[model samples]
Target: MLTPVLIVLGSYFIGGVPVAYLTGWLLRGVDIRRYGSGNVGASNVWQSISRAAVVPVGLAEIGQGLLGIVIAKAVDQGLAVQVLAGLAALAGHNWSPFLRLTGGRGVGHAIGFLLILSWPGLGAFVGLSLLGVALRAIPQFVGLGIAVAPLAALAKGQSLEIVAGSAGMAALIIAKRLLGNRLALPPGADPRRVLLNRLLYDRDTHEREAWVRRGQDE
Candidate 1:
């Protein structure tokens, strides 16, 4: 029991490392959150700093995720324990202890977890996302594909642990997207409408090109 607990906690700390924020500071001397999407994430790293910065930041987040599951699998002998560890690592990115309990959106971290836990789920996500893109849906709908993959796994009758973990991850990622970066509504916009915009267009209602202006994009 103690060993598993330690593994989960350790993975959380590992996931809490703010690679994107630190990377932006190191390379551009500005807080990554202060520019572009005001997000301490790899995407903002690419938009605000040189595109090359995303490589290391992406590697760091993904590697941390893989490291967490690898440690779990090494310490345990069952899929359940490994799944728990993967969720812990993912939660670390969603609510990182290192950054005052705030963290990135967790897609990159999810990539890492999915790689270690279920490649098929990852493939499902990619395949569905590509299909959505081909349908001319917005980019944010592609994000919905993450949820679709796990639900598809459940439909396929995969093991309980794997299916639950995948679905839980999908829920967390979409929840963050729904929350956007703001805690309060920006007066005049309906809450439901704003959330819908975020879920689809990833911007406020009809505010195209807001991303380029910085501070306006979620």
Candidate 2:
């Protein structure tokens, strides 16, 4: 009993490492949260810092998710515990105590968890998400890909645990997208529209360039 509890807690700390935040500070001596998109995720790292930086930070974030499952598996815990650990990791990455409950969008962490939970689902998500990027309609396609993950797992006849785990991961990602990085809506802005934009575009505004470039001059 104690072992499982420790495993879950360890997974959360692992996922809470804040690799992107450290990367930005190390490379440019700036808080990543104050820069591009104000997100402590790899995409923001890419926009705020260098493409090269994203490689390591992205891999590390994914590894955080992967390690959570690995730790649970290492202890020979059952599937439920493993799924719980994975979800814990996602929760940590999404709302790290180290960052005052602020963190990334959990896309990378979700990828990591799904990779171990169901490769077919992960493949479906990655393929479709990439397709969306290629089509210049990232939010729509990414959301579609996430939405399809559990279905893909179900189609492949994965266990109920795997399907449910995949769905849980999707829920985390969607929730983060909706909540954003704790940025407040502009004064007088329609709360509903801003939330819609966050869900659909991962930003407060529809203009990608403007959103990404915000706070750059500061």
Candidate 3:
């Protein structure tokens, strides 16, 4: 019991490493949270920093999720604990304690977790998400991918625990998208519309260029 507890705790801390935040600080001497959609994630790294930086930062985020499950599996803690470890990693990445409960949207982390839990599910998510991106509707496709992940797991004949974990991943991603960085609404911005936009577009406004450049203008 103690070992499982420690594994989950360790996984959380691993996921909470804030790779993008560290990357931004090391490469540009800026707080990533203040730039590029104000997200401490790889996409922000790409937008706020050099495109080259995105590779390492993105891999690290995915590794955080992958490492958690790997550790659990190494201990032979059974599927339940493995699933818990994965979810704990996602939770940590989504609401990292090191960032004062602020963190990324968990796309990379989810990819890693799903890759280990069910590669087929991951394929479904990535395929749909990329399709949406190709169509210039990232948020919609991302949501669709997340929504379809558990069904993909079910179709692949994954265990109930794996299916639940996939659903749990979706929940965490959706929650982060809805809550965002907890930034205040723009003056005169309707609360309903802002939240709706956040849910659908992952931004407070539809202007992607403007939103990504907001930090630079600040």
Q: Where does candidate 1 stray beyond 4 Å?
A: 131-138, 182-187, 204-208, 215-218
Q: Clashing residue pairs in candidate 3, if any?
A: none
Question: For each candidate, what is the lDDT?
Answer: 0.74, 0.87, 0.88
lDDT per residue for candidate 2 within 112-196, as digits (tens), equals 9888888989899999999998999987888888889999999999999989988988898889888988787766889899999
Sorting all predicted structures by lDDT, with the top scorer first, yields 3, 2, 1
Q: What value does the lDDT take at residue 117 in candidate 2?
A: 87
Candidate 3 ranges beyond 4 A from true positions:
none
lDDT of 2 at 196: 93
Where is the poorest 10-residue window by lDDT in model 1? 209-218
Model 3 clashes, total count: 0
Q: Clash number for every model?
A: 0, 0, 0
Indicate the worst ten consecutive residues by lDDT in candidate 2.
180-189
lDDT of 3 by residue, 1-218 (tens): 44889988888888988999999889889999888788889989988877998988889899998887998888788898888888888889889989999999888889899989898789999999889978989878988898899999999899999999999999999989889988877779988888888888888887789888877876
Cα RMSD (Å) between model 3 and the true structure?
Answer: 1.3
What lDDT would candidate 3 get against the real structure? Answer: 0.88
